[model samples]
Target chain A: MPALVVQWIVALVMLVGAFFILLASIGLLRMPDLFLRMSATSKAGTLGAGLLLVGTIVHFWDFSITTRTVATIIFLLLTSPVAAHLIARAAYFDGVPLWEGTRRDDLRGHYHTSTHTLDSVVRPAPDTEIPEMEGDDFPEEG
Target chain B: MMLDVLWSAILVMLSAAFVLAFIRLVRGPRLPDRVIALDLLTIVVMGFIIVYAVRSGQAAFLDVAIILALISFVGTAAFAYYIERRV
Candidate 1:
């Protein structure tokens, strides 16, 4: 392909990537809680960074850089969600409060303090109404 | 010529985004919020580095970007663990 065309392509891709990054940052700034911010950053930030790397790959179009770019993209795709999950899990277990408007939290009663694990047995049935608990149905016995 | 203009424009927007994210990172009320902001800042920095690499025609910077992504991923995960374990 022509150099000019390649350059335009790079420019376009980079612009789109930059837009996503900006959107993610805005969401991060404005979102109410840790979970919402995590949701924003993980998805938009990954796609934005991936697109930027894609622009780099297209610009270089060489063997080594291409390999590295592909590796970087894959690493990002794999790790970002994992990182978000870990952080959100930590926040939840550490008792970070959710937004007031959050309707249903499936994991609310499923977590076992004794085992430090989620008891999947109490997993709410699909389409079943979530009961409003008074407090600590499963009492912590230490 | 046009490509240079486009890249420069994109770089300016990215810098603005970075500054806003930094503000959030500094002012975030909670630990996880701060961590999320930190993650965004790393990504923006990576984007900046890649743009710089493109401008300078240096493939070495791409290598740096890869290393950065690796380090940030690990760092974020470790921090999350510390928050959870509280140790």
Candidate 2:
């Protein structure tokens, strides 16, 4: 590849990658609701990173970066849906209402509050902040 | 020469995905929100890795890329499992 052509290619790819990242930010900030936002986050991030990684590979073409980028994409593909599912499940279990336009919530009746326990990690940020840790004694053993 | 053009084009498309994902990552109202973002971050990193491989002409890095892809899945899975199974 000619130096001029390579330089042009690098510049173009980088610009495009940067633009996509910015767009994801916009979607994150502007989206109206949680599910919608999560949708954007998962799909957008995956795509954006994929582009950037590919760009890096094209520009640098090293073992470390190539491995890192591919790993990144594959990881995103595997986990994004799983995490989304968990979050959605948690939201449903804890009684977070879906958007008003939503027509059905089948899980509401099927999975009662009694069946699934709500862990803090699954919980969204609560309105009131928890008080700071107070003095506590260590456990004693016989 | 032509290979480089195609690769660059792919990056352009990937960039779009990155921003959209970032948007959601930042605005998510729950724990999974951050997890989702982090997950996306890994993907974007992967893209760069691929691109770097092309530019630097290091064929060996592909192996590392594969490993990263594997580990990231595991990391995400662990979190998912914790969220699903934890008391």
The candidate maximizing DockQ is 1
Q: For all the candidates, what are their Cα RMSDs to the real structure?
A: 6.9, 13.3
Q: Write the per-residue lDDT of candidate 2 for residues A1-142, one digit (tens) a residue.
A: 4366665666566556645655655565566665666676566655665565566656655577657666665665666677667666654543444555554433433443445643434332444232233233233557
The list of candidate 1 runs beyond 4 A from truth reads A121-142
**Which residue pairs collide in model 1, if any?**
none
Candidate 2 segments exceeding 4 Å error: A62-68, A112-142, B1-87
Supply candidate 2's per-residue lDDT for B60: 60
DockQ of 2: 0.23
| Model 1, span B1-87: residue lDDT tens | 877788878998799889989999899988888888899999999999999998789989888888999999899999998998882
Q: In model 2, what is the error at residue A16, expressed in angstroms?
A: 2.4
Q: Worst lDDT window (10 residues) for model 2 chain B?
A: B8-17
TM-score of chain B of 1: 0.92
DockQ values per model:
0.77, 0.23
